[model samples]
Target: MRPDLRAHALHWHDKTRATQMEFGLWQVWEAGWVTAILRGASITILVGLVSMAAGLVIGIVCGLIKWARIFPLSLLVDAYTSLVRGVPELLIIYLLFFSSVEFVTKVVTAFGYAGVAESGYAFVIAVIAIGAISGAYSTEVVRGALGAIPNGHIEAARALGLSGGRIFRRIIAPQMLRIAVPGINNVWQTTIKDTALVSVVGLQELMRISFIGANSTRHPFIFYLIAAVVYLAITLVSQAGFDAIERLLRVRTRK
Candidate 1:
């Protein structure tokens, strides 16, 4: 190689090394980046919790209707569960986000509701989309739980002249929930991971923030690693909660 070319090559190599090294240097002692990642993780947890709550309601309602074989509603419930389970979750999020905006805009304009801002539209869509998909799986869990309840217990409840609400709340809900714990735990874990997909729609969840950090610092490895560790920590904590609930319910059953 020519002398000038060799010197330029060496300089370029050293510059690249320095840039890579910056990741190590900053990550070791930088509190701000750590805080940013923590904040992002908080958003991820909030979204997961909200989505799970919505999903449980949807699942319970749909499961009950389908379990009873309610006429036309049963067919509609079947279609919803089939569609959500058949489609990719990311595609659902994208569809909801785009479609909901147009929908809300038209509804608001039609009703003469002024000042409809989209500041939180993405977050709303994320929760609803994730919930819709999670609910489809949860429907099976709830239905199976309901099926496992002996017909005799329901007959006894009916014989006792108990109202429908009392029978369900006192005799059915508890047993069904105990049976559904493991399934719901699986759903919660899946829903948590699914929040990462919402980052694609520009929500500032953990993955999106980590992606931004990676590009800004030219340190994809470190940022992605942090995000992974954060996600695992959240999962571990959530698992512990579910485990405790399962243990409590089991003890109650033994008693």
Candidate 2:
């Protein structure tokens, strides 16, 4: 090719590349997507935190029942854990959402507030479904942690005349917590990502918002990339916090 023709081709290539890069970046900020994404992220975090907390409570109770081998209740807990863990999470969400919405709608309607049921039900269902799933995993975590406690410590406490509650408070509880932290953190990470599934029910979490933005802007790649980054940020921050807590617990155990 002639020198001038080559220069013209090179210029067009550069211009086209710049335009493509600009379009990609532009799509990310169009339509106040950043703000929308932030809002959705907040909801995701909120749902995750509340669900994890609920799951922890459920897990502790069921785990204790299982650990104590408490007859029929333990059997029920086993069934629950098995049922939840055995099923696909999305299937559980679908079953729970579709099955309970009618009852919830009736209950809400009886109180004279009718407008918010469908919208409100989505969040409730998200929490219930995710919490139930998280709890199943957490139950095993707690059960494992409980089993890890050396029987010798409990026996020593008993020999020292400590009551069951007292021994649990001073010896069993702390050790169990220390043993359980890493497992709980793992559950939390899974739980937060699981929030994405709730988007299917119209919960408007980060994933859902990203999907909407991608569709609206016709730039699925950029929007999804942003969603990935946001999820990564949340995970990194949560991991750091859990690591700190683990370190603190280790220091306390030493002292």
Candidate 3:
């Protein structure tokens, strides 16, 4: 077809689809379904943020151990990063669910309480599981960032009689962070997507809620499509924020 005719055909197709949606997409919004999905989305965001924060802490500690080549400790960090990175994230969640649940239950019982419900502890487990996976990747990112800093700079700082803490605080930390931001951002993106996996263990994050909505309403495509759009929105907004941070870092570096 000619260009204008093709455009007209495409527009007509979209209009038809919009008009003929069998269930009327508006129905999904009428009975608080949209509110439920949005609430689930908020949980998804919370899980992602908290998981990433925990991952950053774990990554920094493990990365530093490996970077400093801290003997057997570095070896242990290596094993941790390697194991977590190599495993499927869902398997990790399952492992934590089965393993930690009983142990935590027993502990709670010992403390003069009935065993806590699975749902009660699901969020904590999700955070730890997702954080560990993110941290595994983040360890490599941080280690590489630390490695990128020239040895000469550290030596020079030492030669200037700067204390170890001062050298790290003044020169090393900032540059390492700048170098690591892109890698960390990559991990952050992965972490958010991985939150979807936690749905298997029933954490009620966005994916699980979407699945529930889809099943309950018999509108799988609509709910899943909405989920995709929400995920994309989150990713785009996060990308923009990271981009701004990166540009700001570059400007400071130039100064």
Candidate 4:
């Protein structure tokens, strides 16, 4: 911790119950646990945001490929979406955590990075694992959003002799995004919650830290409740932001 940030944290901790209670509501939980939680919360946020970005990319590319109906690839995509959505999400996380280590180990060794394959690669794999499941659902949302666009609009673009790429760029893409915002927010919310599952892989995310604290303090309810409240706060703020964006889109549509 930097001098300034450490000082600020101490000042904040002093203002709270850290000094007032020898043992907090959770009798065995350590002092200054709030700082630990803040650290974990930041990791959770980073993982969530990065995984959401990966989901969006996967969704957009796969959704467009599915829309194009390209034979074997389309069928494969259908199977992937179905499999991912059908399985329990925790199973998916477990599978990825177990399976990815060896593959990542090989890659890390090839790149001459030692000891990274265990810890750092686990984080990368967690993002990919969470994003993969989120992407499956996102694919359907994006496809549905694109389907909402009228066929006549594309036909008219063709009638005017616009190229296929140009048609998408000038016509389909913008409307797809505006219509897909709600679905995007839904995926975002789901991804954030799903990040908690990554804790099982030893990700040191908010949920993982809370679970450790709970075990050590024997205050499962208190620790879990803190984690729950943090998740709620994050989701609430995300909802507000998405809703504001939706309103802006609506206003633009009206104009």
> TM per model?
0.84, 0.90, 0.88, 0.83
Question: What is the lDDT for 9 in model 4?
Answer: 94
Q: Which candidate do you rate higher for TM-score, 1 or 4?
A: 1
Candidate 4 residue lDDT tens string, 1-255: 999999999899887655444454645344666777788899899998988889889999889889888888899999999999999999988888787667767777888788543448768877888889889989998999999999999999999999999999988997898999999999999999989988887788899989888787666777788899999999999999999999998887788
**Structure candidate 2, residue pairs in collision:** none
**Which digits, one per residue and each the tens of the lDDT, describe model 2 over residues 7-123?**
999999999978876887776676688999999999999999999999999999999999999999999999999999999999999999888777777787877765334447789
Per-structure clash totals for the candidates: 0, 0, 0, 0
**Candidate structures ordered by lDDT, highest first:** 2, 3, 1, 4
Q: Give me candidate 4's TM-score against the actual structure.
A: 0.83
Write model 1 residue lDDT over 11-40, tens digit each, in one string. Answer: 999998887778554863484777777888
Q: Which stretches of candidate 1 lie over 4 Å from their true place?
A: 1-22, 25-31, 102-118
Candidate that would win on TM-score: 2
User: Residue 133 error for model 3, in Å?
Assistant: 0.7
Query: Model 3 off-target regions past 4 Å?
Result: 1-24, 103-119
**How high is the CA lDDT of each candidate model?**
0.88, 0.92, 0.91, 0.86
Error of 2 at 175 (Å): 0.3
Candidate 3, residues 44-111, lDDT tens digits: the string is 99999999999999999999999999999999999999899888999999999988787888887787
After best superposition, candidate 2 residue 178: deviation in angstroms? 0.6
User: Model 4 segments beyond 4 Å from truth?
Assistant: 1-22, 26-30, 102-118
Please estimate how well model 2 matches the true structure, expressed as its whole-model Cα lDDT: 0.92
